[model samples]
Target: MSQLCNVLIVEADSKNVETTVPLLRKMNSKVSYVKQGLNVVTHLQKKGFDLVLLADKLPDEDGFRVLRRIREKAELKNIPVLMMLSEDESKKAAFESGASDYIVKPYMPYELVARVTPYISLVLDRQKFTDECQRKDKIAKQLDEAFTEMEIMSRLDPLTRVYNRRAFLEKITDEQIRSRRSQKKFTLLLANIIKCRHYNERHGYECGDFIIKKTAELIHGSLRERDLTARWSGDKFMILLPETESDGLEIIQTKINKVFQESSFEFKGMNHRIDLSFSSKVCTGNDDLDLVLKEIE
Candidate 1:
């Protein structure tokens, strides 16, 4: 492979270490040497190795015990471990103890490299597949977030930062259905900015936009947390107070009116007052939605 593979050699014999290191390095591999079986797991935990060349005997512990220890660890369990055995050592025992493969001692250099090649290739392929899956998942998550933001932007009035006409209509329709099922009443208040067209003509469109935004802010600030406010159309706003009676409607309307009357806007060295005409309807599920909308308009 083009990528350098990491091979950990768990051998205490200095001759064996000297013989094995150069052969593996010729094939573009980085090798880590640990003398004892006790250090194998610690070394493996610290670095990611593609293949582990475990000696049948170690200075401190048996190779089979080391293999079993690697298998016991959740993170180290899947790493390919090739056991190097003497002529008399049991190859069956190597496999049973979780060796991916085994090499008989006094082996040819080419034989050792040949046996180790396939496992390294397998590990590199698996890593590539895992990296691809993670990349795709990140892209999918970003796409989902982008779509969510687009949906939110579609529902909001860009000028006022409130629900637009289409969004307000959908919300009121759903609320109507809910009110019907619960047998509850809701208050729908529509406010028309009196002589807004004249104001726009007298001043500029920027000043007109400022007045609309200011009116929306005052009305929204005056309402309870549960209330929904929307910019229904040009120079018109709508409010939905859920499960509210006429008494509640009167209280909210008075609060809104008081806020509007107290508020003033400055434009080009002039103070301007906003005048709005309000119409309200107490609606149940039984009310014809189209008729109610027409009446409010």
Candidate 2:
């Protein structure tokens, strides 16, 4: 009784409306009225109601038809519907048409309130449960998105926006297993920026960082989509070319050398040319991963 309730009275009778509206209002219920059964669904769609007071007789259509229509709608189907009937009207027909309960016409105020009160309480409880579930679902979705973003950020190098050393090691390990199973050779290349320390001391650390970032971009752009590149150390990068042999390695090495030789970085109004030193090893998955890393590094 304390919780606010919305009730729709689908009755054409003035006497019934006068009696029912005032009594329900006294009980803290907000009431709406529609004289035609055709308007029942329209009203419910516009402003949802907790309970419906449907008279079997309406000006436009039978009240049973309106109840069935309400039951058909996905949004309004679960609302409690109380069918108001004349003494001679068949209660059996109302129940079959999906009435939650029925009341005889010319009834006492107490009886009407008694039948309508329980449904109001039930609806309010149901609404509260639904709202809580939807809230939890929204929170769960937001948490899932946040966790996914954190996982991606953890795998990436902040400056160059490529895989960091730890993530690259995991990827290369998996690729090694796959290549072994297929008996295919894959190439690993380690690259170092020539005279990187000299540039950092002469120009500044900012210029060195720019050179590193630009080199990562050039190497990433020159490789095939399947190739993986990672920032291995301060001025060193590692590349994994899956299912590649000596010819593939040579082609990639030449391409990377050409791009590096052609590209230049502008620092303090001066264009500084950059160069790289490369070492490569091809493995058929039988090589010790630690030894291979040591030899290349």
- Please report, as a residue range, the 10-residue window in candidate 2 with the lowest summed lDDT: 119-128
Count of residue pairs whose backbone atoms collide, per candidate: 0, 0
Residue 130, model 1, lDDT: 80
RMSD of 1: 3.7
Q: Each candidate's lDDT (Cα)? A: 0.89, 0.90
What is the C-alpha lDDT profile of model 1 across 20-126, one tens digit per residue? 99988887688888888987888899898888999988888799999999999999999889999975457989999999999988778888989987987776677
Global fold similarity of model 1 (TM-score): 0.79
Model 2 lDDT per residue over 1-297, tens place: 145679999999999999999988876678888888986798998997888999999888889898999999999888889999976456999999999899999899999989987877676676677788888998999999999988988998999999999999999999989987999999999989999998799989999898899989999999999999999999999999999989999999999999988888787898988799999899878889999999999
Return the lDDT, model 1, position 238: 96
Give the residue spans of candidate 2 off by over 4 A.
1-7, 14-33, 38-50, 61-79, 85-98, 103-114, 265-272
